[model samples]
Target chain A: MPTIVVDVMPKAELLDPQGKAVTGALNRLSSSRESGSGISEVRIGKRFELTVEGPVTEELRERVREIAADILSNSVIEDVVNIDFGDDAS
Target chain B: MTFRIGVVTFPGSLDERDAQRAIRLAGAEAVELWHGEHDLKGVDAIVLPGGFSYGDYLRAGAIAAVSPIMSEVIDAAGTGMPVLGICNGFQMLVEAHLLPGGLIRNAHQQFIRRDQGLRVENADTAWTNEFATGDEIIIPLKNGDGGYIADAETLKRVEGEGRVAFRYTGLNPNGSLNDIAGLTNERGNVVGLMPHPEHAVEAGFGPDTEVAMRSGVDGLRFFTSALRALAAV
Candidate 1:
């Protein structure tokens, strides 16, 4: 079995409040230490792991791409950042 | 003849009953539509009520948009069937591609609940026919991800075509672009808004107005507008 991973993130132009909050927290922690204040921003996203029982064919890859674009990520506010097939895929 | 409107209840939907009650109060028969079913029960209009459908996983209304019933809903909407999406329902409508743009987390990063004032931008839609263009009304709005966004081109088109159904007035509560609070498709058959009009349909249970507390029944006209749209058909 091969596992396909899909990563989805909010669009770059949009404001990510969750990411901003994390960034703020990181900055606060880094400011207390010398030479650790380089963190600037963070954008949170989602990762979906899909397991297929059989060989990973091009057809399956295409189908996964469609799913990623249409279902896994909403084009209006998010993007399909990456699709990775694990090392098991021959 | 009695008009039949269907209210869809996706898993985690919280406002279907109130929507049904609003429909009944508007002198229309309210039918319950399920997310996992393919039938719409021959409804004249459909409403996707507010709630955290699928617990807002993978984006609000994402999973529920492709549910079994939405296939029927998509087809029916194509044939000009009237559909109203309120609050989280608005998210589903955008996810389903029945309406344009998308709602994102509030700019202030907080859940907002308030009696929101809105100006009717387009009064020709099925759910807004009872209002005149520029009519101001107050509806209770509550949501975490209610900020509306779109590409610059889409915004231009939506504005040029006058598809914006409602605009926030007095104050923009969620930082929605251009103060857009609601929208309608080109044919005016579909409408989606982030406010909970169903919550404001009843006089004693709605927003407080100058005359009395919880006496604003402005939301009732949304259902009545549907009735009027159906009656004229």
Candidate 2:
């Protein structure tokens, strides 16, 4: 079986309010440290793990990529970072 | 014959009853439709009322955008059936590709609820024919993900074509680009907005008016406009 992973993130040009809020909270938490945690940023996104029962053939890879780009992420606002198959199951 | 308008109720829909009531008050027969239903019960128009459908699991309106009945709505909208999406319903419209642009979280990262002022930008749509262009109205607005966004080209196209149906007047409640509050499709049959027009159909239970609080009935025009549209057809 081949396991596939898809990561989705807001387009860089668009604002990520949730990610910014999380980063702001982190900055506040680390402000009092003698040496700040040095955690300068956080960019939040979604990840999906899909498993296939058979080998990850070229056709399967194409189909998975299509789904990841067209359905898993909205092209207008979000983008798919990558689609990778585990075990190099090509 | 009474015009029949369908109010779709998804699993988390919170305003189907109010939409149906508004339709009835507009002298139309209100029909309740379901997300799972394939048929629209021969409705003359459709209203996708607001709510956090599917609990905003993946994204606001993302799951419900692909619901079974949406295919039918899509087909009808293509044939010029009037369809109005409010709030979360507007999110679904964008998610389903029934409308342009996308809605993201508010800039302040907080859920906002308040009476909002809107300027009617294009009154030729099936849902806005009752209001003259440039009319200002008060309606209730409440949402978390309500900021409207689009690429520069798309924004220019919508604006140049006069597809913007309404715009925020007094204040940009959610930081929507260009102060847009609502929009219509090219044919003007499908409209979507962040405000809750269904909540303002009746006096004493809607947004505040200049004379008294909760006396606004400006939202009634949307339903009445639908009635006029159906009558003309």
Candidate 3:
């Protein structure tokens, strides 16, 4: 079984309200998006790990990317989900 | 016919009920779906609710994206069925490649939670048709890994095309590029946002009930929008 990890990223200028809310409270309300953080943009994403039994090869990687692209994502807003397939596992 | 929408539940999903409630509150039927199930139950729209699907074990919605139910979701979204992904659901959309970009950990390195302000950037999507452009809405936003990332070129394209659906207001909670709270595809049917809209569909129970009735039913519009879209079709 080969362990796999997948990551999802968002586009720029898409305000991550959750992310901004946190930055505002950081340092006990010292700075934030409201205070004019002067930060024009932010990015957000998630990581996934999967255990699979497969050979580690370019074909396998493409297959995994295809899985991430078609069955795993919405292709429009998301750029590309990176899949990390680990070495073959017993 | 009344619009029917499906709420997908992965093994570790936490917002299935919330999503169902939001759907029902919007005057649409809510269909419960499981990750292992391959049927859509004739839903007109689909909601990938927020939660720690697959225990967030594999990058939030990574595993759930490949679940049996997702096969149907892919099929439905392709035919122009309205699909909305919230928070973890948003992550799954990105992982599933239905949307662009990915979500990462906050730069502050912590699970952030709060009532969030959002400026509706695009009101044309099936899920957002009820809203108007630049409308400000408040919803509960909570997540650990909600930072959105994408290559520079992709970022430019998403913005240049006016695909951005929502932008954070008041504060940049996470280190997301351009403060993007949500986005829609070119056709404006599929939408993915990092906020927990499900949590705001109820009254005092939601984060932003100060303005409306105790129902805190503002979020219901998301579902109703889809229902109206289906009806128009």
Candidate 4:
């Protein structure tokens, strides 16, 4: 079985309010949870790393992209598919 | 004896320098440690600073958790050496199974930068010995993979044992359950927090204060606390 890997980011174009909310939340939770702390989770975009085994070809790459956009990544708010691998997909 | 702190330099680690500076500010000798190197050079404590190790290529610090140097770091931590991991470093500590839980991406999907606050809940850990039981402090925070996730049992045990060090006060940044900001092992030797305390060490460069941002250097206490713990032994 041929193996391929794909990495993605939160399409730079979309605004990620979740990131903002969390950053702020980390600070609050830090103190609120405590009888005193308020540090929150650091802000960062979403990403996924997937490994699939099949034909390592351009056609397969395109098919994977379609699946990601349709299901894995929401194109309406998130930009998906910044990488590919099948012949030059690295 | 003067404390020797080793700062690991994993490929793509952005905050190692800041950690090193924090070490020096705390009166400890800072040692540069390579992620690929297996030898630890006998440092008293180790720090895994934040940043994209291997460009977050394989699950944020996933690949890095298995680096050669971890063998020593893990062994040391097991033997009660002070091991502190920042943002990416905290991710690595989890991936290595040194600590519990996992770090996921921000649910919002954006890179966030802010002056964050944290309460010192467990001041008994080696890295936090200098802090009071209820002290609150602010530090700079930035990252893209900061969500902290764990099962209910683990969270309960952590609370029972007082392993939950710092907690988020006002908000829940990454949907982390129980609002945990930092944690320590049962022995209280290892610590992993999401904020960058090192960045808040020097005045005019750290977090903002009521009078002026970054004018206070309370964050330096983290490093000093670690050194103090090792010395007490």
Give the TM-score of each candidate: 0.96, 0.96, 0.75, 0.74
lDDT over C-alpha atoms for residue A71 of model 4: 43
What's the lDDT for candidate 2? 0.92
lDDT digits (tens) for residues B65-131 of candidate 4: 8789988899999999999999999888887778887676775666778887788999999999999
Clashes of 2: 0
Clashing pairs in 2: none
lDDT of 2 by residue, B145-190 (tens): 9999999999999999999999999879888999999999999999
| lDDT by residue for model 1 (A1-90), tens | 788999999999988888988898898888879877687889999999999999888898899999999999999889999899775442
Poorly placed runs, candidate 1 (over 4 Å): A33-36, A87-90
- Give candidate 2 regions above 4 Å deviation: A34-37, A87-90
Q: Of 1 and 4, which scores higher on DockQ? A: 1
Model 4 chain A lowest lDDT segment of ten: A36-45
Residues B1-233 of candidate 1: C-alpha lDDT, one tens digit per residue: 99999999999999999999999999999999999999999999999999999999988999999999999999999999999999999999999999999999998889999988999999999999999999999999999999999999999999999999999998789889999999999999999999989988888999988889999999999999999999999
What lDDT does model 1 reach? Answer: 0.93
Judging by DockQ, tell me the better candidate of 2 and 3: 2
Off by over 4 Å in 3: A1-90, B209-215
Model 2 chain A: weakest 10-residue lDDT segment is A81-90
CAPRI-style class, candidate 2: high
Clashes of each: 0, 0, 69, 41
Best by DockQ: 1
